[model samples]
Target: MTTLRPERYSATAIALHWAIALLLLFQIGLGWALEDLPKGAAQFAGYQFHKSVGITILLLSLVRLAVRLFRPRPEPVKDGRAQMLLASAVHGLLYAVMIGGPITGWIIVSTAKVRLQTMLFGKIPWPDLPVGQGFHEPAEVLHGALGTIGIILIGLHVAGALYHHFKREDVIGRMLPGAMKSHGVIGIAALVAIALGIGALICGRLLSFAPANLVTPPIPLPSASSEGDIAAPMESTAPEEPTAVVSESAVSSATATPWKLEKGGRLAFTAEYNGEAIKGSFSRWDATIVFDPEDLPGSSISVTIDLASVESGDSQRDDMLRSDSFFAVGTHPTAQFVSSSIRAAGEGRYVAKGTLLLHGQRKPLTVRFSLNIDGSRATASGNATLQRLAFGVGEAEWSATDQLRDAVGVDFNLKAVKKAR
Candidate 1:
């Protein structure tokens, strides 16, 4: 059998050691820097990236520890009883802290009260932490403290390795990786890792779909007689003329009262995107709106958007929207409005908020519309923005250099004329 040398690490071990070293340093720096950002989209993005990287490192560390335990490592020529024991203790603690820190952090994140994206490569995965009480807050504090402990351990580990390599001038410095030194490969590898990281981030957005369970809009009327005690609507944009349409849920036994399409109803809609101007309102939709105010809580608003009937008079723009980018009529077939909640805003206006469920994702939207009461017909209109990229509605690529805005402003006018028995 071939004889073993004093204390030089093998190529694989050295590479792994260095990789973990760099990763730990990066994690500490990024985490500290990210904590300084205000709680918003910037902080949200940073937290997501930090959590992802931490989980990755923790998994890698576990695997590395297992490898170390099974395989034999080079014994240092000058290794003493005290030095060896110290190294073993330090490494064991390091592994424990790394694993525990991230798990605690994840627990903290899962319990966050804000709407932040908690996804894995764009898949809206459930949080791994327990959902209730005292455990979570304490876990957050522990997560923060343990992160520092990990950093200190890494610093100690690195310093000790270097001391052995330089001060002792031992076999520790002669690691196989140190022997075959190359600048190009390291640079290329770094570039590739960064590129893939960015790509994964971008592509993740497309894959993730987290639906908001909103208070759904007024259920359509099966018949006036089918009304149960109408649940107090969360909000309502329907007029207060003693008629509210019965909620005709597809799954429920209630059959919606058939409404005749009315022409000349006014339309309104709005759009808002991060870092872009709040663009809104182009009312060309004139259609009939009808619903009984007394039956309001049970009635769901339905809109039949006449694409060809659109008279913004901008043929080229309308055609582009109707084609693939905006409406994508060929597959989606038709565009419709569904309300989620109908809470009163003020005066005659109520905030009708809900999911657009566009492209495929249920996009959260809110429209402030007026409820005009005139006989059997009720007119309602409002505005909301659609962030295109957030929902994978378009490529967002304009030209070679110019990038289009992530949001598209949509305006719609809706009139509901009360249908007969």
Candidate 2:
């Protein structure tokens, strides 16, 4: 019992409406598809897309609602009052729910306090909103709940449409596009939707990569106590000549305190992948240390660790990680970190910038460590986050869309005591 004319909708209107709807459905599918992915780069990218698309859907839905509102459409007088009210309510709820869902997601992502960037393949960056970190947990809860509810709402809408088409069949023809009546029109629109969908997927993949587009190369931020709070760059402004001097005063008395590795030292380390935390320990570590507080500036250091003694207690992970694929223990066993510059980060902490020769890839990195001295021993322990690809490890498992990042949370907790000379 349809009274309205069966004329076609404006091409622009129809195109926009279908495009938005299809995208929303695709987003839901993506969310579910990636729900259990391991948490490093791939998951980070997924969540980034989820949040960005959520925001996009919310905005587009609002615009569509407004169009439906200010731009009046002819009413179907033949449809029952129940049908009209139901449709109105459903659309109204969809608009409201879609808008709220992404806002909650954005707040949650902001609050996670994870300074993670989203890069798939293309170069899209997710803009972070100003966040008050204390509310992270609350925001996360709302984000999860609202998204679930919104999905349910969307599912109901689709289910109802199918019910009308298959079960009720009272007015399936009304909701169907006018193009459905013409074989030619139907084929063309179908072709168009498919083409557009494919083109968008390609664009979506192409638009998510973020490079190290840093405005400023990350330097050691100044401490409150540093004179004039100057950020000393790692590289000296003055070029080094081959004739750098080794003074008699520098050679004979470079280090006031004796330097040698301490016994019974412990170093604990932890790694984070995709949100899960994994820990490891190195009980036997040798370090040469100097503790003349006045000669702290001239102090140099080296650490030699036993590759044979690494045990995070999980043999499977330990063995697999130690294999040729990861560390390649049989050929090149031990991992060494040698430090050159030991600058005070203040607050009893120090940033050691040096080369971490891991898996034979010597990458320059800054390892920040804390110090404590008791009678004969001092220890420095902290963690650094770096991309795994930088060191040329784990090559087989990399993809732009589903990549596992090498920038894991590599941490340390070292305990060292001086050995009797």
* The 10-residue segment with the lowest total lDDT in model 1: 223-232
Model 2 ranges off by over 4 Å: 1-8, 76-78, 117-126, 130-138, 162-178, 182-421
Q: Worst 10-residue stretch by lDDT in candidate 2? A: 221-230
Evaluated against the true structure, the overall lDDT of model 2 is: 0.52
**Candidate 1 at 235: error in angstroms?**
16
RMSD to truth, every model: 17.9, 17.8
Tens digit of per-residue lDDT, candidate 1, span 1-421 = 8666535566666667656655655666667766665432233345556777777777777777776776667764467788878777887888777677777777776565432334543243435566665677898888778757876776576556555655544433444445433444434443454455334434533322121111122224232211111112222233222223333353144233334445554443333334544432222222222233344444344333433223233434444444445544334423444543345555655554443444444445555566665655555444445556654554444321134565455544444555664
Indicate which candidate wins on TM-score: 1
Give the poorly placed runs of model 1, Cα more than 4 Å off. Answer: 1-7, 111-117, 121-127, 130-132, 169-171, 174-421
- Report the C-alpha lDDT of model 2 over 1-421, residue by residue, as the tens digit: 7445334444555555676766765665566655664432333345556666777786787777676665535443344788767766776777766676666667665655333333222245555568788777886676566546656666566555555544534333343465375444544554565566545544544443232220112122111110111112223223321211233466356543543434444555555555566677654445545444445555545555544345776645655555445655434445655555567777666665555566776666555666666556555555566655655555565322134544555555445445443
